[model samples]
Target chain A: MTLQIAGGLLIIAATTLIGWDFSARGARRVRDLTELKKSLILLKSQIDYSIYTLPQAFSHISPRVAAPFDEFYAKLAKDVEGGADAASAWVSAVHSLKNSNLDKTDLENFAILGMSLGAMDSGVQINSIDMVITNIDDSLKRLLAENPKNSRMYRGLGIVAGLLITIVLI
Target chain B: MDITVVFQIAAVGILVAVLNQVLKGAGRDDQATMTTLAGLIVVLFWIISYVSDLFGTVQSLFQL
Candidate 1:
């Protein structure tokens, strides 16, 4: 009986934690998207006011932004420093990044942020920012609609599942 | 054979139902459904032995 109780507690803890994690993924994505928006706006302002290049601008802005984005932006800056072109550096950074919640559309949109950077004039650069921001907005809307629902569902599922499993095993 | 098992099942049912309703109010319909199902299954499993024993007693009483 003691062993069964211990097993039940363990199942409950593990399943609840796993379900919470599933829910957190959605929250993480939301955070990343909002942070991306913030960082991009910062990048645009920095570029508009100064003669700073992409690397310097990214390096300047990376420190102030949140994680995953900060790391990815720093890597992009380093890549540019290492002589990779802006596009390649951005692509490599996006591809090499691990532990991010951003999906393929996000990665593609970020790639768009890079593709046109330094390859065009200031007007076009602003346009690229606008484009990525637009994409982020669209994603945010869909994510907001779907993720909270899923997150809550997953949490409830987790606890109930653990209880059921415990009863079955005992 | 423990009578406490029945109480435990009832407790789980009550808790799960409350949780399901809370989750639903919070806009988590999927989780609510899952919690309800889990509560049902767990209660069913907990009572399966007693139920079978009940059937056995009835069968003997009827001499079937």
Candidate 2:
């Protein structure tokens, strides 16, 4: 009986943890979107006010923002320093991302922004950044709206499925 | 030895399918997919030992 209980508990714990992770994913994603929006806006202001170049702006902002995006920006700065253009540098840094909460669509939005920045005039670059921020906002709002319900469902599903297994196995 | 495990698994299957449908209808396709996958894993874990026992019995009977 102890063996049965322990085995059952182990299974429940593992699967429940996964469920909990799924529940938290939406919130993490939304948070990352908002952070990305803020960073882009800051970069825009840096361009407008400080007259910083792409690499310089990236270096200035990279240390100030949060990780794992801070790491991304810093890597982009380093790439630019190494002679790669802003767009390719951004793409490489994006691909190297390890623990990103941003999904494909979010990545796509950022990628589009990167392609439009650096070579353009300040006015056009700021416009592109603003567009990406708006896209991120829409995504953030949608994810936030769905978060509570999704989290609860995943949590309950994990526990219930675990219990059902325990009943059958024991 | 009894057929109870089969019935239990069938019941779980039915319940999981219902839950999946409900969640999907509520416009949560990701959650629904996870719920179904979780159900499958739980059922498989529950039945693995029984499946192994059945295999042992079969091997003994065939003397293989």
Candidate 3:
């Protein structure tokens, strides 16, 4: 009789644990979806920046700007073709730029040269870029704050199940 | 075996799973994955000890 009671408790515990696992998985899926959306947003920003900022910044600087822009364009092209997600591909492209291979650093250096150029244009582009980056960062941070409530709920279920099983056994 | 052991294992499993998800949601993918894997291994180890004991008792009873 005691063995039967023990077996019953074990079965109950197993079922409750499985339930918790599935719920946790659901929470994780939500997080992944949010990340995917953010990645898409960043990709769009990169494309917009390239289209608007590159040409204007290039014309402002010496003719040497074309080469770095070409490299950035090429990297973006490869990532698009490779079907890598926006965030990962952009990060890789940025890393390539950082390596100083060719004239890659030229564009970043241009930005770093301060809003001096942008400020000259009433800082419109600088303000816009800063705003978009800030928004994206904030969105990602918010998404990262989510948590799976499955474990907490499961712990409660376990306690309840444990009590019920104990009562049955008694 | 005591009922407390079963409760303890269940509690730990849920706790670790929650920890894993929390870390993962916070963008700590590697740590989240590690926490889950570690929890699984710990639970398996705990189970193995019980199975071993059961096997020993059975063997002694059968004198095999």
Best-matching candidate per TM-score: 2
lDDT of 3 by residue, B1-64 (tens): 8777687677767667666665665467897788678767766876898899999999999999
Q: Write the per-residue lDDT of candidate 1 for residues A70-105, one digit (tens) a residue.
A: 888888888898888988788888887545888787
* Cα error of candidate 2 at position B13, Å: 7.0
Which candidate number maximizes lDDT? Answer: 1
Which stretch of 10 consecutive residues in model 3 chain A shows the poorest summed lDDT? A101-110
- Residue A51 accuracy (lDDT) in model 3: 44
> What docking grade applies to model 2?
incorrect
On a 0 to 100 scale, what is the lDDT of residue A98 in model 1?
A: 46
Off by over 4 Å in 3: A1-170
Model 2 interface root-mean-square deviation:
2.8
Error of 2 at A149 (Å): 0.9
Report the Cα lDDT for candidate 2.
Answer: 0.82
Off by over 4 Å in 2: A165-170, B1-64
Lowest summed-lDDT stretch of 10 residues in model 1 chain A? A161-170
C-alpha lDDT (0 to 100) for residue A112 of candidate 1:
74
Candidate 2, residue B45: CA error in Å? 16
Error of 2 at A11 (Å): 0.7
lDDT by residue for model 2 over A1-170, one digit each (tens)? Answer: 78988999998898788889888888888778777888898899899999999899999999878878798889988999999988778888877764698888788778887787778899999889889888888887788877888888777667666766666666
**TM-score of each candidate structure, all chains considered together:** 0.70, 0.76, 0.28
Q: What's the best-to-worst order under lDDT?
A: 1, 2, 3
